[model samples]
Target: MIQDVLVLGSGSAGLIAAVSLKIKIPRLNVRIVRDPALGVIGVGEGTTPNFVGHLFDYLRISRRHFYELAEPTWKLGIRFEWGPRGRFDYTFSPQMDLQWGDLPRPNGYFCDDEFSNVDLPAALMREGKAFARQANGAPDIQPWHAFHMENEKLVSTLEKVAMEAGVEIVDGKVTGAERAEAGIAAVMLEDGRRLEADFFVDASGFRSELLGKALEEPFDSFGKTLFCDRAVVGGWERGEEPILPYTTAQTMDAGWCWQIEHERHINRGYVYCSELTSDDEAVEEFRRKNPKVPESPRVVKFRSGCYRRMWVDNVVAIGNSGGFVEPLEATALMVVCGHTRTMVDFLLQTELEPTPSMIALYNEQASKNWHEIRDFLGLHYQLNTVEQTPFWKRCREETDLSGIQDLLEFYRENGPTGFCRYRMPSNLSDFGVEGYLVMLVGNKAPHNKPHRVTPEEKAIWERHRTANIAKAKQGIDVKESLYYVRHPGWQWNDEIQAKRG
Candidate 1:
């Protein structure tokens, strides 16, 4: 049985793994090693509902405490400033995929001319609202909403949680790994100290020390599908900004830029291909677009790929050590939470003695998750209508859609029908059919079949949209919602908390 687990690196991924393992299985010993010299890549990060569930429900962390420390802003969805329509909202809640009781078909069919305000969340996104206002003037929070967090605050909160959960912290820089037949027997520290564990977790960011370097796991690159690699990251403090409730993904000459909103800051990063545009050129373009940034932004390089197997023998790789796609969908932390939860589940089910078959299954699931994300992100590039630039032209012409060809074909013929869900893979991503429909329909992708809505059905859809628009108009902004939640006399709804947990 695995009694002790040593995690290398103290980034968000490492700390999450340590805290999860220690909290879920109190009998096991979890220790995380870190080098004080290595600082985290502090930037703004956006998350999906999966992360919220993992933090508050699966791990049962106190929401109030997390809010106090992390100070995350709520994100209803993403506002994409791309494609033919100029922009569209992709909310966490289902809008296009939904079929109202009074409507004849799914909402996507009627969204040909006007796509906004299809649902409450999308409406809220359009109006720059975080949540709908209740009768008593409090924010009526829903499960579909997510968070936009500053990485430094999030890491510090996770470290605190890890320590409180009895996870030991060891300060050391790993120099080498002592290889064993099963996996790594021990890791050598720079100070000549050796650390041993029954199991190991590698969360060493892009370095991938344990799984990639030490174990020599083969990497499967997504170069064909994902081209943009370098990101110029910088931001500025907020002054009169309204603290918008969604991340903005705007199209650029070479690639795209993300605007992650924070309470007191607005973080921006331009992700572009180094080959297409030089670092200096990209920086110029970024500054031209966002002049509020006072200083030069630093360029961070990365590759898009995944290891052959996340779980090889006794060492399980999590986060960037396992794989990483771009932050187009803001899935880094979501992936971390998922990997940690799965590892904990496997250990618990097997009583800390996971069989070879169980490890194989885990690796299979991990690989599938990576591929699904790659395919979904590929769809974003494949269907984007911004075909003016050379880089975008290449993306539209050459992006690999082999994995999602069937889904695309169906949507092209059937126009975002819910039936496409039946044709999807058994292990579909968390995005589900709704995500694909939103991307396709939002981009106004061409379709052979078009639904001709009758007068009655059109009227019904109009009524629904109008109601959502009214409610969203009356909704609370992030600043207002924060005031209510942070008030000393205010209390979170017990029923909602119980449901989430």
Candidate 2:
């Protein structure tokens, strides 16, 4: 029987895993060991629609409280600046019934019937609106909303929740682990303290302290495909234009830049390949681009890849320690949260037999999920038409990759890159048809189709799209909606305090 678990790290993954386990089995002894020396990547703030039920409900984290502590502004969706030139907003759509089935196309292109109301968010934004608007009196659509939090806020919030739930939080670095023939027998901290547990979770970011050191699973690099390994991040106060309810991911010559909103200041970053651009150059270019609302940003470096095995023997790695893809799409948190949720489910529900077969299945599932996310992130680079610098050109022509060729070919014909679309079961259920359309059609990727459709179906789709757009527009006043949330009295800005109350 599993009596105790030692979670090694304090990032989202480590905290989430601990909370999930505590919520599942209250009596299980769960402890989080965090080292003050190791810094969190601290850049993953954007989230997907999955935050609603998967993360909030599972962690027993109050959604409203989370928003308040994180000083979170609602994220309708991401605005991608493709080719370093054009911008397109992929927002939450309202259209219904998008499924994976044989669809018909008129021009030998695989045409999915799931393209309705995909532009609703963009259209609303064009008219100055927030997608997930929470007003006092009016009935809200409650569309997909995720938080744009200071990563530190998220960690602190989760730490409080996990601690209150009876999980121990220890501040110390793990120096070594004594291993037996079975697996790790006990972990020794830098203070010369020994802690023994039945299971160990390696959430120690890229270091992979417990797993990497004990299991010795070599890390597999994605340097060949992903060029950007370093990032410089900083914050700026909301300017006179008012805080935008959406996150902007602007493509640059070497990499991409992200603009996220917090309560006091807007968090911004320029992610680029260190091999291509120096830190000083990136800083100068950022200053030149934005002359207003200025603050110096800090630089952080990283490798884009994961350990060959996320879990081996008695230990399982999560977050950056397990693997990391580019933050082009702000997928860092989504991947980590998704994996931790799955891991929790496995631990709570499935009995730990310690059999070779059981371990193999767990490893296989984790590896497949991680690789799928990596390939999907790689798609943003591989399918680009940008040739601005050696980075973009190399991305467009980068070979020696695996897994995504099928997805790319299918998209070239079917419309939409099907990269890592099947990782989570809830993705399809929550997103619906409009969601798929935004990714497939908005990105200018379609499939070769031969399914013939009658004029009746075509007319029906057009009519539905027009009607949905009209209704979404009428639901709320765009400018007024933004004003409503930005109001300080709304009490959504104090993320930490909200949770305590």
Candidate 3:
């Protein structure tokens, strides 16, 4: 039977794949081939709530170890500083969908002017606080929100966890591939050992060692829709600056700057189009904006797209090796978590060797997932009109939002009502109608004829917003909350932990 798996690279993708498979199939031999010379991207990475759910629930990694090693801080939502509305939050929970007490329409139609306080989490994000506090105000348990992490530490933490699971970690690099009829038969290492396995997972980041270079998979670029390709990244030691609980995405001269929060340091990066802004100019602008950044920022070059097929025979490319989009919405690791989970389940369900139809189905689902991530991020650019710079102006004027055209038209007509739910796909969609609705309402997109709310409905909306604000005021900032959780007296509610899994 198929009992062994060789996973390339030791990044989060490879380690998670190895660990999950070993956990799922107890007798399987899983070994990770990594190159010691190459280093991880080491930038700030963020995850969606699904990732949080998967790690502790599906994969069952220890939360205590994760907190201790990853140095994670809470992220309820992203505070977007873009478009006409200036600053708004796309929270984990549905912001506008909770129709308050039989209102004539959803509250979004009335939130065109001031919208952030519609949901409790969004309001909490606005005030730089986290958690929904319980009575007596001891920092309550963390919510089902995501996390902001140092990417390098995240990978290392996962690697340690994999080691605990009996996954063999080896130091090696792929020099060549020994091809066979349906797929790769064996991978040749630089040291001349040929490692063979029933399945191979290519998680080699941009190098894409097995799938891209070895299998020679054709790439489909999202260049038409998502254009930014480079990031000027840097951070400084955190001293006395207040540690906020949300990621800050601020619009800049040419592109945008992302400020990711951490316990002892704050990471910042400028993602911009190289066509409109040069490396030197981007770096200059980055320093101009973030004066506190100590050393010169490093630049990371990347493309926006995926392989034509995520699964090809015995090899499946996960993470950046498969495809990538700009860092908008913090999709990288979330995508990694999802594809890894799907891949492991599929492998086990198929009796360890995937059939042609299985591979085809996986490809179809993965392709749709990649494109949806593109369209969702594209939705962000299509409606943004905040900065008047060449990059932002060109984005508003030229970006191809054809993928989400029908969804956009529906929202424009219906105005964030729960009526258009059937239009979006239930599977392979990263964020459902909830994500789109938040971005749409937050940007104050125009509708030809808006829903009129009665005085009674308006009163209810105001009361909801007021209640959210009061609850947020009772909550504490990120550092204080994390310290509370790390205390010796801290104990997770048994009921909550059981449901979390």
Candidate 4:
């Protein structure tokens, strides 16, 4: 039976794994082993709606408290300087099924030109606003949108909650581990201490200390499909610029640069293929684009893929230990929360030595999730036409379109209308028809024999665009709206006005 659990590494992944496990099980004795000397990578600045749902519903953390401490500005979506048009906004809201009144097709068919202003959130982002304004003149928050936060604040906040809930935080490094017949029996710290647990959660970032180094698990790489292996990450404090409620992904010489907004600061990073451009050259390109960045970019090299199996014997790897992809969609925490949720569910159903079938099912689920992300990200690079550098050209010609090939083919055959009707497995494919449609339409992927919309349909699309733009004008900026929500006397009584999350 699984009683005691030890989570190694104390980043966001480790804390989340520890707390969520304890929260779900309630009976599991959980403790975290961490080395405080390892400084935090305070660059993760974006998340998906799944993370927000996890925050409010699953984790039960206070929404108000999150804003007050995390220095987060809401993110409606990402503005992509990608594709042939060289600019489009990928909002959190649905674009695929968003049809006009008595229209033959969804609005996406008409979004080929005005893609940025196609959605309500996209319109708000174009206007440099956070949310649509309610009649109360307050900035509204949408459930569809997510947050862009400072990484240090998030990890520290989670650590506090986990510790408060009885997770013993041990400060030390795991120097070694004791192996057993089935899996790891215990871990040895640098302080010459041995700690034992019925099960181990390896949240050890990229090191994969327990699962990779100790267990020597075979890795399943997606290098052929996802080629970004390095990031030159750096940012500057906010200035007179408006705090956007969306992240900006501008095409770079080698790969792409992400502009993430925080309340007091702006974080940016350039993820590039090391083989196409040297670290120094990527740094030069990054600094050239973002001259305000006060320092040289720090190079972080990472392989893009996951383990053969996330759960092996008595050890389960979570976060970067299990797998890592580029921060293209900010899927790091998604995997963390996802794996933790599944692991907790499994433990609740079975014991430490879960049968081989149970393990296979878990591994298959995790692998599918990882592959889905890999393929989705691949779609982004494969269709991007804004840049024609050696790296991007190679990506376009070489990257494999795994899993989503059928969907792409369907669109190629029938255009962007029938995507919602396309059936897909529930293997944790985070991006639904909407997500895929946004990227596909945003990139202007051609549908053969395109049906021409009459002037009437065009007028309807234009009317919707005008209405969205006008509504966005009433919305407030990220800075002002967050303050309004955080005011000690703030209150909400609206389904009429925009909402808050």
Count of backbone clashes, every candidate in sequence: 0, 20, 0, 0
User: Considering TM-score, where higher is better, how would the candidates rank from best to worst?
Assistant: 1, 3, 4, 2
lDDT of 2 by residue, 1-501 (tens): 778899988888898878877887777799999776776667788877676456555665665555455555666677777632355666654322243233333211223433324346655544445553334544253645666678888888778778878999989988888996766878999889999999888888877887777778898887877778888777676655555657888777678888886656777788898888898888777666665435577888898877887778788888888888777666667767677766766765566444566667667776766565565556666656755688777777873346656444554554433332442222312343344444445455545643455676566556645655665566455345545655665543235575687
Q: RMSD for each model, in Å, please?
A: 1.7, 5.4, 1.9, 2.8
Best by TM-score: 1
Per residue, candidate 4 scores C-alpha lDDT tens digits across 78-178 of 88988888788888887665776677777777776667677788889889998888788876667888888888899888888888778999999999889
In model 1, where do residues sit more than 4 Å from their true spots?
494-501
Higher-scoring candidate on TM-score, 2 or 4: 4
Cα distance off (Å), candidate 3, residue 54: 1.3
Model 4 bad stretches (over 4 Å): 351-353, 420-427, 491-501
Count clashing residue pairs in model 4.
0
**Candidate 4: 10-residue stretch with minimal lDDT:** 492-501
Which regions in candidate 3 have their CA more than 4 angstroms from the true location?
425-427, 493-501
Question: lDDT of candidate 2 vs native?
Answer: 0.66
TM-score for all models, in order of appearance: 0.98, 0.82, 0.96, 0.95
